[model samples]
Target: MNCFRIDESGYTGFDLLNADQRFQGASAIAISDEDADRLIKQHFPKLQAPELKYRALSRREANHPRLIGLMRDLLSDFRCVTYVCDKRFMLTLMFVDYAVEPFYYERGFDFYAGGQNYAMASMLHMAGPTLLGKPQFEALMAAFQRSMKEKSEEALRDLVAAARATNWMELPEVLGPLAKYAAPECLEAISTPDLTTDVALIVLQSLITRMEVMSEGRYRVAHDQSKNLQTYTEFLQRFIDHDANVEFRATEITSLKFPLKLTAVEQVDSKDSPAVQLADVMIGAAIEAANNLAGLRSGGLDAEQVLSLYADDQFIHMVPSIDFEEQKRFRQGSQSGELIDYLAGNVFGPKKR
Candidate 1:
């Protein structure tokens, strides 16, 4: 059976809309146990404390040319899969929809229209430092504060009512002039399910899909041990087991017919697992590439250039191609014209009809 190790970058708890949080990425590496040990002994024999992490690699000092070269070399030895989340757009969609319930409910709070307003305000505030700038963020905050002070309950109800009336297709109109200020990429990142859940599913789905395509439909997965990740894995396993016949989507191609059967799902310490460490490095690099593409970072390899080296190269798999241009057009009300109707049809009605 093929063995894979998984690790993640930029996990900021359930507060996906935090101003400092930009991206959430998960990386999986498929490598033989023998090769994993060999590579670790050869390359990271002297691994130290506060060992390599994505955030450190994102910095110019930590991502030195030599280290980059070493990472490039390591890429050749394993099959890699990565999923990056656009938190801003994900949170925005959640705030306006029923998806926000899970987030608040998980924290012992009941979700309501008032909660939606609070979430929207938080999202806007978080976007201020990066997308809107300090001044605009303050202005938006002032507007929100005024609304709260004047007619807090009524305003929240109105906002919720408006959101209920609108759909994904009508986001631009619903947002009005404020739509322009919202990044096209952000708006486009919205998906049917929440972003974190989508990423988790995609990562596992892609790993299993690739395994089936390369080998048989047999594999075991090992992920870096963490309480939060453990919960996610258990939830995902339940999801998979509950619907054995459900087709796996979210691959580069179309759906996979074969049901994913894991020989075992294990969590291991990164300190002991070379495969997990490699996954960490690869995910960090993927995050840096994404940040470069999003204009959040610079003075290093361009994202497109780095991605091209791995594109369809059989080594690295980039999941769910992000088309900024297409997303921009969608934001401008050009493409996916039926989005509103589609959403309206899918979303629950007042009477659950």
Candidate 2:
């Protein structure tokens, strides 16, 4: 069995749109402990206290070169697998999948099967605020997000009120399509709490599956000690044990060998685990590169070099970005309108009804 050490960056539980926690990055490496230590010495020969895991290279601007150098090893030597997601986009996806999808599914339509969830999430993320008026839409999203963590009747009522509040607050034409689903009738779907609906937990779960698919065999995992991981570790292990089929519109999405291979999950101190620390640098660098790429922040790391490492092996890396113009305070530069223009001008066929 191959041992993989995994670490995460920008993990802020469920409230994702906070200014500092916009994206979640994770990297898993198969490098042995001895090799990882040797590589660390080369990167930071004079490393002192707190070690590389606690003092991550991706955190400081000065250490970016060493991060890129180490990332080269990930690209060539170990062929590490990584995962990154725009948390804001992910929240919108939860809004669509959890709340909106069920509205249609109850009527016998498969929301994901039809691939409407993707389009809906993208549209909402990029233009929902503009179409519906930013304040009310954000309020509605906030209520839904809070209810995801707490499944109380009060939370459900707030979400329903937020949805209905949009009728008067949003543009008339836009509310017609959304009003039905957002209506309180769909409270059962929206209010049903799911432990597995968490972002960090979901990232780790998806990354593990992708890792299994990329490198076949039973797996042993070592993760950095975290309350977050501890919070969802059971769900993570349980998620893999099930051999359920994931069909999107009558097509199978799972191709990994049966019983879904996993041997054990161990939470370890990064001070003791060389590979976890190394994985930390990789994940941190990936998140920095994503910020630079998204134009949310610029010049903390080499976007070109970090992104090139991603191109080396496509299957082992899953980096999905949802960057577009928006009027949000944190998304100030999004007003440039470059991405939105491209999205609009792209040629595409309409989905089948």
Candidate 3:
């Protein structure tokens, strides 16, 4: 089998498992070129070898977020694994979207497991259906494209209506293309062509739930102090009610002293800082909520399936410089006077690419 191994300090990727005996102490491991080919053939019998491709990502060229975003873009719908090689690595059977195309081929190698390590692989593949007709695949893709274009609920309703009217439901069984656009609510409505009382009730319930969530976000962002306080109080009540006998303490409370007064030369962190580390917690919550919303809309949860959305990694960058001539002056190290003048020109500049 083509496979790769990463044993604590050494790692290697290859076309065959000839050196399988050397795989030891691997924090994470994955199959290589030849083994990978065999594995895919074993599990996805219908998929052909020509449809598979190798992709590697290096830490030196991209950070984790950027790497993840790229992974989502290129292999969101494909299976991939990492082998603790400080790189994003994966093998894909198909291109999910525009994020991955015209795959490139490159080569370089390093030592692994007390021996020389080297391998060759291509990063792209051309997709062809195993049995489904080309026109069938094309129609399925058209449905998917229609779904992607319908962002609003009303638009989604229209697409769902049109799909049912045109009999696209039968396509999902033979082609995976419609899976991206198949929504649960639409499925329910389709199953019960006539809206039953239960279906109506469920739709109403979902609407109420969505409205409550939107109201909460609005309250927080609009600085509606009264609403925020009321919402917090209700949350505490529900939380305390969950285990009435247990002691409970508020973990988050606005500090009584904010923007603490300090004399010159007395170092103190900004009082605006949070008492607890919430930046990471909030970021995680945001990711989870977004994931949930995406799942609710799509009616499926495939981590790889949604990768294309984040392919173009966007991030903030900070560059230190002043206006035109002064930036050049600073770079040139004109003089001590120039340094002071540049510093005085602008204390901070906006983040730039």
Return the TM-score for each candidate structure: 0.59, 0.79, 0.17
- Candidate 1 vs candidate 2, TM-score winner: 2
Candidate 1 regions exceeding 4 Å error are 44-63, 92-215, 248-252, 256-258, 298-305, 313-353
Write the residue-wise lDDT of candidate 3 on 26-46 in tens digits: 111122334433444443355
- Answer with 1 or 3, whichever has the higher lDDT: 1
Where's the lowest-lDDT run of ten residues in candidate 2?
343-352
In Å, residue 127's CA in model 3 sits off its true spot by 11
Best-performing candidate as measured by TM-score: 2
lDDT, candidate 3, residue 287? 31
* Pick by lDDT: 2 or 3, better one: 2
Off by over 4 Å in 3: 1-157, 162-273, 277-353
Against the correct fold, how does model 2 do in TM-score? 0.79
Per-residue error at 125 for model 1, in Å?
A: 16
Expressed as tens digits, the lDDT of each residue in 1-353 for candidate 2 is: 78888888787877777887677868888888899999989988887856785234455777777777887876678848777888878887777766665556557864553334555577777777776668988897888788877878898777767767774344332233245445443556555434323576556655765666666667778887887667545645654555544311111232223345766778999889888888887777777777788788876667777777765343222222243222122233221122212212321111111
Give candidate 2 regions above 4 Å deviation: 54-62, 167-185, 195-197, 240-258, 312-353
| Candidate 2 overall lDDT versus native | 0.63
lDDT of 1 by residue, 1-353 (tens): 77778777767655444566577767666776567667655654665644455455445554454446546666565566666666554444433332233333335543332223234434443443455445543343333223323434454344333333333233332243223333222222222222232334434444555555655556777887886577547734643444235342322243444245565678887777767777787777777787777778775555665565464633333322244344333234221112222222332111110
Instruction: Enumerate residue pairs that collide in model 3.
Output: 1-35, 2-32, 2-34, 2-35, 3-31, 3-32, 72-307, 76-304
